[model samples]
Target chain A: MGVQDAEPLDVERIREDFPILDREVGEGTDLVYLDNGATSQTPESVVETMSEYYRTYNANVHRGIHRLSQEASIAYEDAHDRVAEFIGASGGREEVAFTKNTTESMNVVAYAWGLSELGPGDEVVLTQMEHHAALVTWQQIAKKTGAEVKFIRVTDDGYLDLDHARELITDDTEMVSVVHVSNTLGTVNPVSELADLAHDHDALFFVDGAQAVPNRPVDVEAIDADFYAFSGHKMCGPTGVGVLYGKRHLLEEMDPYLFGGMMIKKVTFEESKWNDLPWKFEAGTPPIAEGIGLHAAVDYLESIGMDRIQRHEERIVEYAYDRLTDHDDVTVFGPPGDDRVGLVSFDLDGVHPHDVSQILDEHGVAVRAGDHCTQPLHDVLGVSATTRASFYLYNTREEVDALVEAVDAARELFAV
Target chain B: MVGSDMYRQQILDHYRNPRNHGELEDPTFSHVGENPMCGDEITMDVELAEDGETIERVAFRGEGCAISQAAASMLSERLPGKTLSELREMDRDDVLDMLGVDISPMRIKCAVLAEKVAQDGAEIYLGEKDLDRTSTE
Candidate 1:
């Protein structure tokens, strides 16, 4: 759908699509789920899609020539096509590969590219706000390859210091990987600009879109991202499936990271030939039902229009940020203006995040409390942990009010 | 006032003004325990008597929610006048009884961080095990 054709979301109608939204938490209290940053609630359509796939065509994909296998293969390939279209990948399904999750996708890049391309003097540039999936994977690979790893600094207000990024991305930089949207800080990075900068330095760029692709409109072609990774579970789809999109030329140049049955064209006692484009990277039986479920989720988002979802989450998060900061005891982290995405991380004076989250749970408000997989970023923020409340398309302003009231109850109980 | 049953007045008082809330000048055993998931940490410093089996004095330093800090404070107070064997024998129920509150399954780690630290410290002091630190992951 075009951006101009996007309509405002009817949140009340949308909430009905998710049965979990109607459930109760503690003492029969209505659940206020604000943990979308962790995992989004699946719609009934996506759930039904997976259930139907197992019930109807319960067979292996790609190898079997039987009717069920053909049907499953067609559906799985179509799922990849849907994902490629959703992200505006120019090479379409040929450039998209499925992995267990975003972590595995990054590992695939590290194994296929980093292991072969990087050497002792090569540098891998990453941001300080990266989730451990990107940080630890590259750290270990750099160690194994004897490649140096550099980190771009985050400003005190929680932004990637572009000046620092420019200073760091010089001649020796062989790879630049960054999070498109920070899970902890909710900072929406200028990824396209970063991608251009990396290309200018003759470096490969990778975007960890685990937090970005689900919440906003992303066109890999527009941003010129050499590689992008995202998970289905964070976007109203089932777990056990993720997507990795790379340029066709780069994908062809890199060797397969996984080796198994379906990914082989022919196998002999002495030699084996790899399969074509995406399947060469996708080994083993693959997550057949999960890929189909992700397709349904992509259709659901497309029906609602991503532009509209982005606007709704923007309003909800801004309102939440304002309400949370109104209290003297609360201190909200991240950018002060409207540059942030759909989450808010904050701390209460004299009250631990776990305590705040526990109290919020008592009121049936679910939130995330911890380092959010970015321990270094937490250290940079000068705090141990922060309570985070994230919003999605189905969230409403009333729920934001409920979150504020529960937070108030926590502060009052702690007498902070 | 939701979950007030878990945050009783005693827990709050101990959390606010923790007893034995400092480090000992010289300690027979000092160990740090951490629940990295919640960023809760507790450090216990115990000074043994001449007999080397009884805890003569103890102090604790920590940063965490009320359950962890209050439980650590209470554990520090109970350490003195208790033998090392008794300290080792202290279990989850004892910590729950000391808190006098219902700790949910998720917060049980926060509630029992102190007991683990002390017991592990006692083990290290006795040369029963060689370890760097303790973790309630």
Candidate 2:
């Protein structure tokens, strides 16, 4: 398709691909799903790919020489290649390791890398905007190793405290793990600059790309991330599958997180040697079907082209920000410009987020009402929670209009 | 499915103009209950007469969802004349039933935010410092 002739994403067609969006909660209201950041709706192609795996090549991968086993193994490894290519990994297929989700992927680094490299008096720098999955893992590692965990304070506008980050990264810092995007504020962090600073200080940089991967193109090689982690469910794929991309040299040096059947190259009674990269990190029965589903999700994303998706979401973000800012009661967080992704978090005057969410739900507008799993950021903002309405390719400006109208209705309903 | 009339007129009546939304003057007992998962916070204060067993007045101050604020408003009107024992016996289901709605399981915490605050305040009034007992209800 030519640039001008390329058809805009058909919301109705995309809506039909998701079966769950059709179900009505109350009355005849159509589901105005805006919670894509929490978990996106899977397309039919991804769901069908998973079902096909179970129906045809339902065998444990990389274990047997049978036809079904070989097919399943090939499909599984092909998924690794697709994921690696999608993320711009240069280490080829060996760099991708499948885990349960972003949480598990982060835990692998915390256990394998942090345990080995981090010691007492060492500092692990993190940001205030990181999700608990990234924060808690490092806190646990710090507790066990007696290493200090330094936090980069956030600016009042919810961007990273870059000045504080510079001060925090010292010679004693062992690693700098930060989120590529703020899940709550929707601020795209400066991962490339942070990675450069960490490298200068002789510390490795790990990025939590769970929110970044779905909204924009994530080239791990371009950012030069020593370790990167992301989840499939947040990107229109099935759950129980995630990718942990590590530098080949780093994965080679780190020990395996788990020791079990699939990860072993050779096992003896007294001693056993682990396998090489990727498989060394994956132990026992992996989520083979989920991996297949993720591959299909990558296919769907590529078909639309990441550049197109980015443009589409950027438009929605700009539209929503303008609409929300027009209201006198609405308080939109994050940067004012279209520098962020599709997520928009805000609060209405005289109405709590829970109340706002309920009123929106009555109109079939699904929004998230909570801290968005960034408690430290919430604490800094001095608000308990804010209602978030995140968009995807399927969302349109009309839906953002619906959201604005719902907020106005809520304001009138709760006028006191 | 809860009926189309799930949010009762009474609930809306309370939510639209919540009663006792301000503070109580020199309250004898005050407690704060926070839903850490969702960031809903409710602070309740109870003032007792000289007898100290009967609630003279009750008020709530906090920010939360409608279910929570409505429940708090309803509880303030329901418990002012009642004894402390009756407030302690209140359950989350009782609050939802009073609201006249079948809330989703995930939103049950919103419905119970006020009840938690009342229970915590009651425990504090009886000089019980432990929060575990208050959290159970």
Candidate 3:
């Protein structure tokens, strides 16, 4: 396939917003960071956002009766409104809860919702491509509740096999948790279809949006998922901050995931009534600065528009696919189409992924090489590990060129 | 070029033709250790001499990076006559010395993965030898 021009993203102008982009690495080579699947470098606006919060309204939220507390509280709560709207959660701010990261968000639902609901003979269905955050939580919940765990096999072409999903989400299935996009394979699952199947079986559907939220648009209501979880850091926000969007009814019905200072309504010696919707789930001191930074991050993403970012990434992916596949020594993994996210998992013919990654790193290009937390998927793919190059809004076509050149160099280096 | 120095000729040679790499038939001890984070697996099999302390033969079978596979190959050449006690005394620095190159901290696990498997196999060998002694005694 002939490579087309990348979508117009004003990447140079956007790059200016991220200060780290200009930093030099490895004997003054520009950092060609392709590790977006792990975390994204925050723009200056997001940095200033959290700094301004600490410099100005540094106070605990919802408890103190002071001006600083109120200002911080409003900013923190507005993060929820922004995230809810960003994900198209029709329930709005009331449905969004903050946690440390996507792992914590999934655990909240598993412990509070799954533990309370699931029991013996119940099955929790999961896709084989789920990251450990999405997979292990359900496993823990299953162990605790004596609920059996079931899996929807990944298709040979690198998709959540919808046919297998239909068979797995039986009447006894209590929940179906799957990643919105396979972090390793870049395959975007048909989550709305899977959610529908879960609904048919009267099972709850949770989408792990850690890899999806930052890359593409997500609509929790449109997808009809009972819960959606994503990390702030992966979306140009700060670490120690994540958002979990649940159906308002589910949030109201489920027991509290954490219990302490902020989440209490009326706590006597013997009994305690939980606080309203989200605050009940967030106990202790919340990630005040991180949440505010996430709001700024949302604003930054909005200014660029997620649609444009996604298109830009898709164009980059197309060009990368062309460039990498043109090489005789490389074989790309995942579904054979443009339906994937802005990432590629591939391996050189004779180079182990770690060695390939080392060669890439030596050339001042960064990529992830390992099982990528989808061990089962890797096992199914007949590879112990794969080298993955994941892109985001800030990554440019030049970086992809750097990656391809380095990979080719790796092949040559190992040729002997 | 130094850019490709990490995959030195020695590393490449060992990876291309790993020494003593196969399953040992009816081995006295064997264990498969994995650096799960990097997806490197090294299964070490050892055939003990009648003395039950010397490794009469040592072989490895698994898949990993140049550092790991090459290190395993290097260890196979180094371990044939070493007694279980001497093998047990081998440590991270010794393995790094055997590789004869500077190993970055990040890739140290890859460089030492074979050593971990070999030591684990020897540990199990000791356990089995003691059990046999107890059963016979």
Candidate 1 per-residue lDDT, tens place, A360-384, comes to 9888899999999999889999999
- Which stretches of model 1 miss by more than 4 angstroms? A1-6, B1-3
Worst 10 residues of 3 chain A by lDDT: A1-10
lDDT for each residue of candidate 2 in A1-416, tens digit (9 for 90 to 100): 53234446666777777888787766778788899999999999999999999998899999999999999999999999999999999787799999999999999999998998889999999998899999999999999999999999888787888889999999999899999988888898999999999999999999999998987889999999999999999888999999999999999999998889899899989988988779999999999999999999999888877777777887888899998889788888887747778889898987778778888888889999888888778888888889999999888888899898888778767665
Q: Please provide TM-scores, in order, for all candidate models, with all chains considered together.
A: 0.97, 0.92, 0.92
The local distance difference test score of each candidate is 0.92, 0.86, 0.87
* lDDT score for residue A188 of model 3: 86
lDDT of 3 by residue, A1-416 (tens): 11133246899999999988787776777789999988998999999999999998999999889999999999999989988999998777889999999999999999899898999999999988989897788888899999999888887788777778887889999899989988988888888998899999999999999988897778888999999999999999999999999999999999998889889899999999999878998999999999999999999998887778888888788788889999777889987647778899998998899898888988788899988888878888999889999999989888999998898788877876
B11-113: candidate 2 lDDT, tens digit per residue: 7778778899889879988888867776667788898778877788999887666777788898888888777887888887788877887787777887888
By TM-score, how accurate is candidate 1?
A: 0.97
Q: Which residue ranges in model 2 land beyond 4 Å of their true spot?
A: A1-16, B1-9, B21-30, B47-56, B120-129, B132-137
